[model samples]
Target: MDFKLEFGITDEGKLILADEISPDTCRFWDTKTGKKLDKDRFRRDLGSVEEAYQEVLFRLLGIN
Candidate 1:
């Protein structure tokens, strides 16, 4: 299954995972530098984001 996760950075730059997940959405940056991150080319460069999410889930679950 595909899902989305929101990660928030703390005041000290620590990353925290929020407790919500959605399937029909992913993340995007709304700035020039963010644009430079090439999110729009993600599908071409990294396949679907859903595939990436599955890899992450595999690591998180110690499945491989």
Candidate 2:
């Protein structure tokens, strides 16, 4: 559930939200198993990195 957000100031001094929110840029875990389903898999040298990302996509978009 942890994520990162970026902010930027415009020429008119207006604060704007920047940056993309995705599995590649944030941490996602399974509530039941506490399994990582983000980029951390690749960082930790865990196998099935592709499957992890696909799981996220399926959970979000209901796709297989």
Candidate 3:
């Protein structure tokens, strides 16, 4: 599941966006394979945890 990226205007008229849009805030998964692609991997002792985080960052940054 993905967290909502909510935007709001504060009482002082300041713009704010809640949520980091990172794996820490989202429970991503490899849908077809049913692999956990978030921090749960680390907690569950699954390999490739770093790669999973990197994948999320790469996608967020639009990097190849």
Candidate 4:
């Protein structure tokens, strides 16, 4: 699991996280099958984009 972050500078010279984290911003793969479970499916025309996103959600929420 790898993710990206965006930062912004506030008027008071504070650096704050400026991006929403989601599957679109990260890469995930199945540990056993090495299948991609991120946005790559959409970009690469791999199909099952929705299912991949749902799988990620289920895994994150500890669902079966």
Q: Which candidate is the best by TM-score?
A: 4
Candidate 1 residue runs with Cα over 4 Å from true position: 1-45
TM values, all candidates: 0.33, 0.84, 0.64, 0.87
List model 1 lDDT by residue over 1-64, tens digit each.
3346779999999999965543235444324443312233365574565555664466558997
- What tens digits encode model 3's per-residue C-alpha lDDT throughout 1-64? 6665878899999999965777877899877788888998989989788898987778778997
Question: What is the TM-score (0 to 1) of candidate 4?
Answer: 0.87
Candidate 4, residue 48: CA error in Å? 1.5
Worst lDDT 10-window in candidate 3: 1-10
The reply for model 4, stretches above 4 Å from the true place, is: none
Among residues 3 or more apart in sequence or in different chains, the pairs in candidate 4 whose N, CA or C atoms overlap within 3 Å are none
Q: Pick the candidate with the highest lDDT.
A: 4
Q: Which portions of model 2 show Cα errors greater than 4 Å?
A: none
Candidate 2 lowest-lDDT run of ten: 41-50
Model 4, 1-64: lDDT tens digits are: 8999999999999999999888899999998999999989888988798999999899989999
